[model samples]
Each structure stands twice: as C-alpha cells, then as structure tokens.
Target: MKRIKWVLGLSLVGVLAVSGTAYALGSGASGMMGQTPQFIRTQNQVGISKMGYGYGMMGNYASSNGAAGYGGNGGGCGGVNNGESYSMMGGPYNAASLGINLTDGQVTTDDQALSLAKAYVQVLNQDLSIDEIHEFNDSYEVELNESKTSNKAFEFLIYKNGGYISSEMGPNAMWNTQYGHMNGRNSGNPGKPTVTAEQASKTAQDYVNQQMGTGYSIEQPEVAPGYYEFMILKDGKDFAELDINGYAGQVWFENWHGPMIKTINNGSTTK
Candidate 1:
C-alpha cells in the first residue's frame, strides 16, 4: 500500500479563501495575463460536498474502487475539513458519492439525520449532540457539536430524495454558497474573474505540471460566485480537480484520484 497521508475533506473545507499573492503579469515586465472570457463548461459534477471530505465523515473508501467527488453546500468540514476516515484504510465505503447533482428524493428521516451527526463525532472521536436538523430544498442539513459545552461551530449536510438515504462520503468538497456572511450577516461581495477561461486553463496546466511532475489536460473553468472550478481529467476519466480565483489566478482548491488514495490539503488555505 502507498503512504496516502491526508487531511480528508480538504475538498470543500480546506479551500475557501483566496490568496493575496499578486502576480505581476500585466506588462512584459511581469508577462502576459490574458483575459478570462466565458466560463468553461464541464460534464462531470465536481461539488465539494463530501464540503469537504465533510466527504469525508471520512468514509472508508478504497482507492482501487475509487468514487468520484461529491458534496452539498451550506457549512461544515472535510479533510479537506474535519477528520480522517472511519473505516477506509480497512474496508466498506459509502455509496453516496453524489456531487451537486443530488436530485433523488424529497424524503426525511430522523434516523438518517442523526446518523450523520453520529458519523461526524465518530470520526473526530469526540462527543456530539444533534444540535439541529432542517430541510433545505432537496437536502437535509444536519448540525452537530460537542456534547455539553455548546460548541455549534461544526456543521454538515445529509441528502435524501424519495427513500434513498445518502451522505455522499468520499473526498468530496463543495463551494459553500454561504460564503458571503458572518455571524448571521452578509460579509462582503465576491471578486469577479479578471482572467478568461483560456488564461486560467494555462495557469492550471502550469500548476499541474508543478505539482504532479508533468502536465495534464484540463477543461474550462466553472465560474462560481468567486472562484473558478477546473475539472482535470486523464485518459478521458476524472483524475483531479483545481479551484482558482479568476481575479488573481490563485489556485484555491485541488484534489486528485488514484487507486485508493485519499485527498490532500497542502496548506493552501486563504486564496
């Protein structure tokens, strides 16, 4: 087995903020920073649901039977956010690897909701209570915290439609639609992308080569409220993901797939 040291849900959780590092690519002195045209559309669903390897709970998924990234929005942790896998290094992973395309049932379950809470606490090996469970459109949001002292800081989501109960665990990350608020109030506006898809793709390619020792093919970037989501593929299959700021070409989020490897967060927070 390979040494797959990871933080887990680093998907949705670890990559939230933008890097303030300014690239001097304006004139020939700094180089050419191209314009970012329309957003790059992709076929694969890359939601940081699992906001994070929140994918995390981290499930006991196998690298060989690797699942695609999945996640729901709202707030929470991944290794990408919270903790490590419960059984992954052992066996038996979750079946819920659904990304933002979680359109299955409109059902609800007290047991299902509670299970998510339990899973989270189990992973952290901490004591927690079901703080709250509310219905949000097609998904059920679950909240949890330490059993007694009232620490409502950690939160996650559970999705269900019809009778299909799912947590979509894996190294899935999600872009929290709730990014623009603080203490129950709006914080500020998100920055718009200054670079075009072509420009961002070139930056992403350069990043891939720097990280993986070789360049890989990438699709156009998805324009969210603030960041650009790039779905990287190899041999026409989902291999990795990259999130960069359109305004500054900052790579915000990233995750790779392998024969049972977990996600990694290389201290690339804030930017």
Candidate 2:
C-alpha cells in the first residue's frame, strides 16, 4: 500500500510539471491549471465608474479589483500618466517668477486712461508747491441734455500761499484770464464802452503768438459777449485752446490746450 501511495505521489508531481510547461507554452488547459482560481473573477471584474492607473492593462485590472481608490480616473484633476498634467489652481508660474519694477514716467500702453490721469496729478504737484495747491476729492453727477446748448464745465480750485485765489480748467485759470485782460483789454473804455469779441480774440492770439513764437494760431475765437477763446494751432491743426474771461464772462477754445498737445501730435504722426 505504501509503494502504491508513493507511485501515486510521483505521478501527481510529473502531471504538475507537465501542466506548468504547457501553461508556459500557451496551452489553454495548462494555463487554466497554472492560473489562480480566484484570478478570473477578481482580475476581470469591472472597476467602479471611473478609475485606472498609469495607462496600462495591469492598472485597469488593479482598478477593477477595487484595489485602487477612485479607480485613478483622475476626474477633474485630469488623468495621471495621461501625458503631461497641469494644475488649474496654480496660475502661470513663469509670470509669477518675474519681478516688476515701476517708476515715474514709465510709459506703457496698458491702463492708458489711468496713466494719463496719474500724469495729470503728477504735473499738478510738480508745477505747484504744496502751499500753492489744494486737492479735493469730489464726484459729479453729469446730466447731459441734448436740447440744451450749454457748456458742461468744471472748475478746479488753485491755492496760493494758503489762500484760494484762482480756479482753472485746462490752463484757462482766472489769473491767466486776468493777465490777458490787463494786457489785451481795449484802452478806449474804462467806464462805459463796448468791446468786440474779435478784438478780444486778436489780443489773446497776439499774446500767445508773442510768447510761444509763430507756431501758434487761433483755432476758435471766443463767441461770448465778453469772453474770448483762442487756440494754438500747430501744423495747420489745433493743438490746444485757451479761454479768456473778459471782466466777467468766460471764453473757451476747443481742443487746443494742455501738455497733451505734443503727445497727441506725436501719436498722429506715428499712426
């Protein structure tokens, strides 16, 4: 009986070796003998809705087996091992890496309106001393009426020596107007005489021309009774204008005034 048992054992060992060889050789029966009994059900099982690893069958197998949480579907984070991955939360790293240096008079096209406004403020501060300037933060509600032919005007106060002495808008200040009157007012009447708008315009133009050379010309004449508007025209075009108040009324010149004149001309040429 012992001999028979030993023969049976030897036979079993030989069969196992043959089966292993057959499996290695790609035999179906041999493969089945070599495979774990649980493999077909576990490895072939479908994973949860979404999950996978490293772009391979083994990863999918792992996912299906529920060994990998979330099945490595990558979801919103995109898929891992699905080529290059990027972070939505992390902004452009290169942009953050660069340092920005800002200084005065640094011209940039970005934020142009804001830059111009800042430049205007800078010019004011630089041209006028702290004692000669008073800044007020104010807001205006502008109502535009198409039927009314009126000038929508504003006044900016100018302080000198701690006193509010004058007001100006685009270089047409009260003091400038007064100076024009002192120099350009008709000598004929100190009490009761009429002065023409043309005469006032001529006077203002002559003053500007004399001071700034022949490059200036009158673009708009002051049309009001006592006020005169004169513009400095350059290259056959109006660059900046000034309004003069004759005794009481204000004069206005259109589109021919301020430091922006040169900048505007330069832009035109470039365009």
Candidate 3:
C-alpha cells in the first residue's frame, strides 16, 4: 500500500458556486459540533433490508437479507461511543433534545457551522483545524487538519438545521482501517492489502453497476489504510463518492452527502 502524504503548501483557493448557492470558501474558518447517529443501510445482492444504529468501527452484523456489513467508527475526536441520538431513525437528524431550535426557514451558514466544529474539536482536546468545507443538500461536511503539521485529520458532517455534527461514515471513519476511530484514536496497523488501486477501482465500478444504473464511471482510487475511496462520475463530473474495503472488498457508499452544492478549501492552520 502506498502512503498518502498531504502537501502543506498546496495553493487551494476559491468558493465554488453550485446549485445557485455561492459559498465563501477559505481555510481560516471557525469550528463544528453535533451528534447525529447514523442508521446505516447494509445492502444485499438485490436490495436493502434492516437498518441499525452503527456505532464504533468494530463488530460484524448480518443484514436482514443475510449480507455481512461493518458498522461505522463511533467515537472519534469527540464523538459518541454509545450510539446516542434523539431518533432511532438512521441518517442525519436534528437534536431538539440538545436545545437546538428548529425555527422554520432557518439555515446554518458556513461561518456558524465552522464555529461549532471548532468548539467541538476543542472539547475533544484534539489539536485540529478546518481544512475544507463541502456543502451538501442537508449538511456541510467539514474536513479537519492536524494543527501542527497541517495534514488532513478527519471529516465530519454538520446538519444545516441545527449544526449537529458526527463522524463521516465512509472512508474517513470505517474504511480507514488503520487510523480509523474503531480501533481508537490513531490505533490499528492493518498494513497494506493485496488488492491494488486498479483492482479496487474495478470492484467499486461493479458495485456501482449493481446498485445504480449505467452511464456511471469510477475514478482513480484514493488509497486509505484499509479501504479505497473512489469518485463516481457521470459525464465527467463528480456524482457520488464511496469506499471499498481493501481486505473484504465490501462497498460502503457515502449516502449522507445528498448533493454537493459547493466545495471550500479553507487552507488555514490552527495553533
């Protein structure tokens, strides 16, 4: 397996506008916070059945259809360890019990979400900074970086309604077998896998074809510790992103990001 190194001084700029929303993109943004437990879908050969609150990256469970699936990394950089949430329903949700007011027509701004994220990071006692911000249909995915080295740390989702945050489900949490939160912070040493990037790409493409229809192409693999993250493109544009387990070849799609509205590269370093 190749070790992926992030260059510190990459000249990432601009707030890309998408779907009529223009976000001010920068690296010097504030923070993130929340706890929305995911109700992950474990797929079978035909479709999906059964939904479970996936907490922690360990343990194995069989879907209602009898397909094996891995749970998500639960406690990471100030995340809940015991599957805590207001709703038993999976996916992102609002936390009214946490005093998050849901006034109609209210949307969370980038600055506000970043502020919440920073506060959450501080609460975890982790020295991390905001690296990137991705706007989706329902939430904003905040990519974090190590404060000292300025290297990519982790990513989390902040729901728009209440700024509720949680560990990103796919590669950042589960498929990242080595640094994944499942084995605890920066624990686990899964080493390399026999499946090459090219092979992983094929597996991802096959999974996509099975789940989705045609006209979709898989991009090059983003090598992680225990899995490979790939971008699904349609007509040469990013459509969705998913990860494949390097050891078991299981597919985990990032279904949280409903639709990407814009991407912000906040290249700021935190002290």
lDDT of 3 by residue, 1-271 (tens): 1111222221111110011010110111111012111223432211332353222223333444344433433332222223232211132333343334445523456555556556556655677777667676666677676789765566666666555556664457545554455444335665666556665576566656655556677878766566677767756656667675565444565543444566555633221
Error of 3 at 112 (Å): 3.7
Model 3: how far is 239 from its true place, Å? 2.8
Measured with C-alpha atoms, the lDDT of residue 100 in candidate 2 is: 24
Best candidate, TM-score-wise? 3
Q: List the residue pairs that clash in candidate 2.
A: 51-71, 52-71, 222-229, 239-256, 240-256, 240-257, 241-256, 241-257
Candidate 2: segments with Cα more than 4 A from true spot? 1-147, 155-194, 222-226, 248-258, 262-271
lDDT by residue (tens digit), candidate 1, 82-120: 232222112121213211222243334455444544554
Q: Which of 1 and 2 is the better model by lDDT?
A: 1
Model 2 local distance difference test score: 0.26
What TM-score against the true fold does each predicted structure earn? 0.35, 0.28, 0.55
Q: Is candidate 1 or candidate 2 better by TM-score?
A: 1
Give me the overall lDDT of model 3.
0.48
TM-score of 3: 0.55
Tell me the alpha-carbon RMSD of every candidate.
16.9, 41.8, 14.8
Per-residue CA lDDT of model 2 for 173-236, tens digit only, reads 1113221122222333333213345544554564455434565666655332234445456666
